[model samples]
Target: MAVSTPPRRASRAPTEPGSARPPGRGRGLLARATLLLAVPAVVVLVVFFVVPALRLLWLSVTTPEPGLGNYTAILTDEVSLTVVLRTLGMAAIVTVVCLLVAYPYAYLMTIVSGRWRAVLLAVVLIPFWTSLMARTFAWVVLLQDNGLVNTVLGAVGIGPLRMLGTTAGVTVAMAQVMLPFVVLPVYTTMRGIDRKLVDAALSLGARPVAAFRQVYLPLSFPGVAAGATLVMVLSLGFYVTPSLVGSPQQSMLAQFISVQVNQLVNFGAAGALAVALLVVTLVLLGGVALLTRTRGTRSSAGAGVAGGLV
Candidate 1:
C-alpha cells in the first residue's frame, strides 16, 4: 500500500539567445552589411560628384566679382540662350528618334529564344566594346562627301548629299551612338513580360495589335522612359560627335563650355555653363519622373484588374 512511485519530474527545454532571434536580429545584420558596402560608394560619390557640383555652383555666382553676374549673362546674352535652346531641342529630337527606332527592335528581340536573344544582345552591345571616338570617326567616313552614303546617293542620281558638318549629320551620328542605350533597357523590360498574357488576350478574341497595345505597351513604359532619359541626357552633353559631325552653328552646351574654358580662358563662364546644363538636365529628369509616375499609377491599376480577373 506504501509502494507509490515518486512523481516524475518534468524538464523544461533550455532556450539559447541565438535560437530566439530578437524580432529584427536578422534584418539588423543585413542592414549593417548593406551600410558597410554602401559607405565607400557614398564617400566616393560625395568626394567626386557632390563636391565638384557644389564647386561649379559656387563658381557660377562668385566669378568676376561675386553676385549673379554669370547667371545674368545666361539670361541677357543671346548667344548663351541660343546655345541652351539648341541643345534642348537636339536632345528632345534625339530622345524621340531613339524611342521610335528601339521599340520595334526590342519587341522583336523579346519574341526570340534565349540563345538567339543572347546573339541579338551581343550584336547590340558590340558597339559599346569599341571606342566611342572610333565609332564617331567611322560615321565620318560613312557620311563624308564621296564616302559610302554620298556614293550611294550619287548612284541613285541624287547629287552628292552634303552630310558632313550639318545638323542632319550630327543627329544621324548621335542617334546611332545612343541607340543601344535605348534598346537594352526596352529589351530588358520586354523580356520580363509574361508571353502567356499576350496569348491569353489573343485567345479571348483580341487581335495581335490590340493585345500588344492593350497589354504589352503599358508594361514597357518604364523601360521606354528610362532609355529615353538616358539618350536625351547623353545627347545633351555630347561634344565629340557634335564637334566632328555638326556645323559650327550646331555647337552644343558642352562645346560652348569648352570654348569658355580653353579659348576664352574663363573658368567662371565655363562653370556657369556647366551649372546651367546641370540645371536643365535636372529639370528634364524631374519632368520624366513626374510623367513616369503618372503612367506607372495607371499601369499598376490596370495590372491589378487584370490580375484579379486571371
Candidate 2:
C-alpha cells in the first residue's frame, strides 16, 4: 500500500476530423445579408436591362416575316452600309480628336498645382452637370447659319459657312461632348505616374520628347486606351447632337434606328439596327482591350527585366 504508485494520468485523444470545425452561424448570417442586398440589384437588372435587351434580339429575329431579313438588309442594302460606314468613320474621328486634345490637357493638369488642378477638373465636369440635350441644342445654336460662330466668321470677312449638317459639325460637337471623358482618365493616370522616372530620364541625357515617348507614353497607354474606347463607344450611339447638327448623309445607326422606330413604325428593323450597333461596339471594344492588354503585358515584362538588371 505504501509503495503504490500514483494513479497514471490518462492521455487525451485528438479531436475528430470534423469536431474542430468552426460554427457556420456567423458565416451563414453574413451570406444571407449579402444575398439580401444583392438580390434587388440582380432583379432590377434582369427586369429592366436583360429583359429588354432579349426582347430586342427576339424582335430582330421574329419580326418582318420571322426570318433574317433585317440582318440581311444590313449587308444587302447600300444605304444601310453607307450609314454604318459613316457612323464608324465619325466615331473614329471623334475619338482621335478627343484623345489629341485631352492628352496634352491631361499632361498639363498633372504638372499644375493642386488648387489649379481642382479648378481645371471642375471646368471639365461643368458640361456634365448640365443636361446633355441642352448642351446639344446649344451646339445647334452656335452652328446655325446666323448663330454666334457664323457671325464671328462674317465679322472676320469670311462667308458664313454651313457648320450644321456637315460631318465636321458632328465631329466638333461630339468631340466636345466626349472631351471630359478622355481628359479625366488620362489625367488620373498621369497623376499616379512617378515624376522621378521622368526626371531620371532627363538626368540620363534623354531629351524631354524622348523621355515622354519612351517613359511617360508607355505608362499612360492604359489611360489612352480607356479614353479612346469610351469616346468611340459613346460616339457610336450619339443621336441628339448629330440629329441637331448633322445632315441626312451624316446620319448614324442610332439615328437610323430612331427613324425606323418613330417614323416608319418598323420595330423589327429598329431592333435589328440596335443589335448591329451593339455587336460592332462590342467587337471594337474587344479589339481595343486585346491591344491594351498586350501592350500592358509587354510593358510589365520590360519593367521586370530592367529592374532585374539594376
Candidate 3:
C-alpha cells in the first residue's frame, strides 16, 4: 500500500503596485556613453576653431575705431572690389575645368579593372603625393619665357606664350591642383553606381548614349556638385600658387589680405577682407545646398511614385 502525496502548492512572488519595466535601458546607456566620449572633441573645437573665429569677427568690427568703417571702406574701394571679382571669376573657372577633367577620368576608372585601374588612380593621385611648393616651382620653370612649353610651341610654329606671371599660368596650375579634389568625389560616386541598370536599359531597346544620359548622368550629379563646391571654395582662398605664378593684376582676395597685414601693417583692413571672404563663401555654399536639396526632394518623390505604380 503506497500513500499518495498531496499536490505541491505553487509558489508566487508578491508584486509591487508600480513596477513597470523601463524599455531600452541598454540603448540609453550607450547613447549617454557616446556623448561622454564626444566631450573632448567638442572642447578642442571650441578652444581652437571657435575662439579664433570669434576673435577675427571682433577684430573686423572694432580694430579701427569700431563704426563699420572697415566694412564700408571695403565696399567702396575700387581695388578691393576688383580683387573680390577676380577671385570669384578665377574660382568659377577652376571649378569648371576640374569638373570637366575629373568627370571623364573618373568614369573611365569605373569601367576599367585590376592593374589598369590602379595605374590610372595613381596617376590622378600623384599630384597629392608631390610637394605643393615643388610643383609650383616646376610649373614656374615650364611657364617662364623661353621655357619648355614655349619651346614646344615654337617647334610647332604656334607660340612663345607668356604664361608665367600671368592669369593663364595661375589658372592652369590651380586647375591641375584642384583636379584630384574633383576626381575623388566623382569616382567614389561612380563606383557605387549600379551598372546593371544601364545594361537593362540597353536590353530594352534604348540606345547607349540615351541610356547613359538618362540614367547615369543624374546619378552622378551629387558627386559633381560636391567636387565643384570644394574646388570653388578652395580656389577662393588660394595664396601661394597665384602669388608665385600670377601677376599683380591677377591678385586674389587672399593675396590682398596678405598685403594689408604684412606690407601695409593694417590689421583692421585685413580683418575686414577676411570677414568678407567668409561671408561670400557661406552665401555660395548656402545656395548650392538649397538647390541640391530641392533636386533631391523631387527625385525622391518621383522614385516613390514610380515604385507605387510598379
Q: What lDDT does the true structure give each of the candidates?
A: 0.74, 0.75, 0.74
Pairs clashing within candidate 1:
none
lDDT score of model 3? 0.74
Per-residue lDDT tens digits of candidate 3, residues 177-292? 88888898788777877899899989999899999898888877777777887788788888878888998777988888888878998777777787777667656777677766
Candidate 2 vs. true structure, TM-score: 0.84
- Ranking the candidates on TM-score from highest down gives 2, 3, 1
Question: Lowest summed-lDDT stretch of 10 residues in model 2?
Answer: 1-10
Q: Runs in model 2 with CA error above 4 Å? A: 1-29, 300-310
Residue 175 alpha-carbon offset, candidate 2, angstroms: 0.8
- Worst 10-residue lDDT window for candidate 3 reads 3-12
For all predicted structures, in order, the TM-scores are 0.80, 0.84, 0.82
Candidate 3 lands at a TM-score of: 0.82
Per-residue lDDT tens digits of candidate 1, residues 1-310?
0111111100111111122222333467676675565566566666865687677677667777797777778767889878878888888888888888899989889888889888988887898788888999999999999899999889999969889988788888889888998898787777778899899999999999999899888888777878887787778778888888887777887888888878988767777778777666656667777777677677763332212211
User: In model 3, what are the clashing residue pairs, if there are any?
Assistant: none
